[model samples]
Each structure stands twice: as structure tokens, then as C-alpha cells.
Target: MSEPFPTIRRPADRTQMILLFIVLTAGLAAGLAIYSSATSFITFIRTASSALFLPILLSLVLTFLLEPVVSFFERTTGKRTGSIFIVYILCAMLLYLLMQFIIPQWQSAWNSLQADLPRYIKGMTNYIRDLGLKIEAQTPFIDSADLVERGRSLGKDIVNTVIVGTPQSALRLGGLFLMVPLFTFFFLRDGSRILRSCISLAPNRTFEMVHDLSYLITKQLSHFIRGRIIEATIIGIVIFIGLSFTDIRYTGFLAVFAGVTNLIPYIGPLIGMIPGILVALVDLGIGGQFWWIVIVYFLIAQVIIDNFILIPILISRYSNLHPLWVIIAIILGGNAYGILGMVIGVPIVSTLKIIFIEIRQYRRTFSLSERLPESES
Candidate 1:
């Protein structure tokens, strides 16, 4: 008799089918929600956009950055509470010094510009007339008066707009300023607990992979943020000194703007130069000397910072990305969300690049396995 037929059960496809159903349902729900949101959104996006989020984002980034420091403190003190308390105290003191000392000096410089406006305006007018005379002497046919009048009209338009809009903008800004510190304090206090709670919910099968990615993201983000602050601070101080040496009247204000803009990566240097050049033009008028000297200073400073400072740090940390990719990311980000996007685009791109690399590696290994010859049976 033939061996008794044993029951053979086919592998259940239920698990995969359930997963596919869940994914499809989620996708459909997301699509519907997004469509509804697009159709019925009620908030003014600009008003909704707040710097209140900045401190929270900064605190989250800071928590990661200072995690090692906090951990060291914990190790020495043998208590997490002590570590957090000590770290927070130091951070608070630093912030207080920045607000009390640095900001006041910067504000003083700004006030000086406002006070010396009449002198600056007179110097500018004389310089412009001299330029007009030289141009008329060189090309005795062109309408110099029309050109000068148009320039004055444009300046008046810009000044008028600023004067009209500033108070409203300030009121909006005051609201966010009130909110940022509160958000930051909570983020700093609870960030680790929040992270751990989020991590705990990840599926067991994917936990290790997720944890590794989390660590990588933490490192990359912290490095990028900390490096940016340091670089911007250094650039701002250098610009202040360089501009003060020159005859540009708004040196301090321009330098501070440049430093703040420098946080935006590749596009930052170009953006930072605009205020400097404009102030230089306004101060010395439209003369070749003013333009040439301002351009030269900007070029020299950018060269020094780009080659000597950002190169070594960025090249090693973001060796995976190309300059072309960086530029594309900046442009896309700027178009999508303006300055904030430009500032954050490169770091976001770097994170995505890491994820893409891992995915590609996994796919390649899987493909190789499928292509290999089977053993003889």
C-alpha cells in the first residue's frame, strides 16, 4: 500500500492580504483628507506660520545636540534629573547673556543709523549729483534728470511700503515672540520622554532598523544645526569688522543681517550680500568706487568662509551629496516656502539621501539573491 497521504497545508496569504488592505485604506483616507483640507482650509497661512515653532524646533535639535553632555552629567551624578537641571541652567544662562549683551549692542548700532539718517541722506544726494555730472560729461546725449528722478521715486516707494507695513508686521511678530520661549521650555523638558514614547510604538520587526535610522538622523541634524550656528556667528563677527573698516555707514546692521542669512547654506552668501550692497549704494550713491569696494569685500569674505570654513566641515559630513543636488534642493525649497525652506532644504535632502541609499542596497542584495543559480536537487 502507498504511504498514507499526509495532510499538506498551503501557506496562508492572509497576513500579506491584510497588510495590503490596511495600506490601501490608509492611502485612500489620506487622499480624501488632503482633498477636503485643500477645499475648505480657513486659516490665513501666513498668520498660521509662526516663529513660535522655532524655539520648539531649536530645543528639539538642542536636546539631541546636548544629549551626550547630558548623558555625561548623568553618568557622573547618577541621576537623570540632575543632568537635565544642570544642562538647562547652563543653556538658560547662555541665552540670557545673548539677549542682554549681544542684542543690546546690535540694537545700539541700528539706533545709530536711525539717528544719522539726515547726514546719510545728504551724503547720498551729493554723491548721486556728482555721479550724474560725470555721466553727463561722458555721454552728452542721455537724460540724466529722468534717470535720477526714477531712482528717487523707486527709493520713495520702498521707504513708503516699509513705513506703512512695519507696525502690522511688528504686532504679528510680538505674538510669536511671546509663544517661542514657552514652546522651547516644554520641548527641552520633555523631548527625551516624547522620543522614547514614540519609539516604543514602532513594530517589533522594524524596531532595530528604525532605532538605527533615528540615531543617524539625530547625529546629522545636530551636526548640521550646531555647525550652522557656529559658522553664522563667526561670519557675522567677521562681516561686522570688515564693514566697519570700510566707509559704509550701516555696517553693523548689514553684518548682522548677513550673519543671520548665512544659516541658509549655499544660497545664503548671495542673499546676505544684497543688504550690504544696497546700503553701500545708498551711502556712497551710485558711484563706481562704492560698487567696486563693496563687491570686492563681499567676494573676499565669501571666498575665505567657503574655502576655509564650510568646505572641510560640509564635505566630510555630507560626502554623499553633490553640489548640484544641494543647489537644486535650495532652489526648490525657496520656491516652496521661501527663506525657511532654503535654510532647511539641504539637511532634509541629506536625510532623504541616507534613506535612499539604504533602500537601494537592500534592493540590490535581493535582486542578486533571486538571480543566483539554484543548487542541484
Candidate 2:
């Protein structure tokens, strides 16, 4: 009867099950503790401005973006340091040229925007008053005068903020700008050494796994950053070109705003719309439903193209994340790291996924003590 079909399990099997459960439970507790501590550390590090750590972190991010160019130059020159300098110099020149050509237009648009603010507010208020008149018979709650007063107060506050905030913002940015390139140079020059040092921390059994995990994270991360940058550029250019053909005021500013905000995901596009909406309402003279229609149509069109066409073509190819997970990652990252968190959240999550996958794949390759029966161990 085939030994009674081995109907009863061995005591060894029960011991193995207990060991597995204990191991899993311990691991879960450790993981949660580690995660909490890591986030706290990250938050602390993010607040430091004078620290080399911030620059080093920024360099790592830029390295991922500029690795290809650096590699190409390295191959041609056979000198990593030389390649980095050449790339930096080239970047400086390109930036200078771009600023030379584009800054004037931006300056002009900004001035125009500033000058038009009060007039725009007045136009909007007058239009609202007209509309309120039409609706006042039916709705006694409509108050155009109150809205006008509030609008002017808001405009004045915005103007004051621009006047006071720009200097501080520029000063902070200047410090980061200097630090980023300085650190990026070192990272580009000695990145392999850095990687080697990090990999050295791994156990002998996981040396190969560590190497492969690093490669996987770097590959996916670079792809994601490159894709995001290209996507932003494309979106900006599309908006610029589309608005150029339309009658939108401050096209350059609006395009730039949209592109920059597009980095934040989900909430980004809506924030981008704020500036555009404000500008459109001002230019279109409020009760101009035709221009409102145009704005709505443009927004809908951009949404369709961004979600259906550009996203799949650009970002989805690199990170196969579901929208729900992405939204959650953004929220968690934002809560933990603020803007930087939101920006790096998806890539961070993707890298974590890769690490876990590597861990699982190599789990069996570890010592058999845990995998074997207690008697065998």
C-alpha cells in the first residue's frame, strides 16, 4: 500500500514550518524598523545645505543622467577625468548660449506679465460685474465688488512675493548650482571606486548578487531619469509650439512652468494649469467663453496625448509601474522627502523592487542550513 501513502507528516516537517514562520516574522519586524530609521535619516540629510553629503547625492543623480555622455567621451579620450571636464565645459557653453538667446524673451515675458496683472484684474472684475448683473436678478448672493477687492488684494500679495522671494530663491539655488557640478566631477571620475567600496560591504556569497543588483539599479534608474527628462522636454516643446499658434499670453513662461511641474506626477499637471489658467483668464478677458473653450480643449487634448500617447511611448517603456502604485509612491515619497521625494519616488521604488527581486532569486544560493530540515542542519 506504498507505506500507507505517507498519510502522516514527519515531525521534521513541523519543525521546518515553525522555523520558517519564526524567520519570516522576525524579518518583517526588522524590515519595518529599518525602513522607519532609513526614512528618518533621509529626512535629516535632506535638510542639510552645507554638507558634502547633499552634493554627493546630487552628483549621483546627475551621474545617472550624464553617464552615457561621460562614457562616450571616456572611450574616445581614454581618460575619465578629461571626459568629465570636457563634458562640463561643453555643458557650460551650451547653457550660456541658451541663456543668451532665451533669457531676453523670458525677461520680456515676465515684465509683460507683471505690468498686465493689475489691468487683468480690473478686466476680470469688470467682466465679473457684468456677469453678476446678468445673474443678480436670479441670485442675490453674487457680489462682484467683494470679488474685485479680494482679487486686487491677492494680486498685490503675489507681486510682493515676487519682489521679495526671488532674491532668496536665487541665492539658495546659486549655492546648489556650484556644489552639484563640483561633486559630479568627482563622481564621474571615481564612480567605479565608489561602487566597489559599496559592493565590498556584501557577504562573500552575495558578492555576485550585489554586483548584479547595482548594475540593475543603475540601468533602470538611468533609463528612468533620461526618460523623464526627455518627456519633460517634449511636453514643454509641444506646449510652446501649440501655444505659439494660439493667442495665449506669456507662452514661454507657461510652457516652462508646465514642463517643470510635469516632474511631480498626478498633481504636477494641475499645478501647471494654474499659471496657464490665470494667464488665459487675463488675456481672454474673463467672460470670453470662446477662449475658455479653447483652454478646456487644449487641456483635454494634452491630457489625452500625455496619458495615451507620450506616456506609453516614453515613460511606460522604462518603468512598467501601475498608476495606482505610482500615485502611492508619490504620496509616500512626498510625505517623507518633500519635493525631492516626489521627484525620485518612482525610481526609488523601482530600485527597491529590483533589490527585493535579486534577494529572492539569490535566496536559495545562500547556505542550506535555513533551507534544510533541522535534523540535517
**Against the true structure, what is every candidate's RMSD?**
12.1, 13.8
Best by TM-score: 2
Candidate 1 global TM-score = 0.64
How do the residues 232-342 of candidate 2 rate in per-residue lDDT, one tens digit apiece? 777788777766766777878778778877766666677677767666666664565536534543564357667777778767443556578778888997897666677
Q: Please give the TM-score that candidate 2 achieves against the real structure.
A: 0.68
lDDT of each: 0.67, 0.72
Residues 115-147, model 1: lDDT tens digits: 554454444455666788899999998867754
| Model 1 global lDDT (CA atoms, 0 to 1) | 0.67
Stretches > 4 Å off in candidate 2: 1-46, 49-58, 115-160, 286-305, 317-377
**Which candidate leads the pack in lDDT?**
2
Collision count for each candidate, in order: 0, 0
RMSD, model 1, all Cα superposed? 12.1
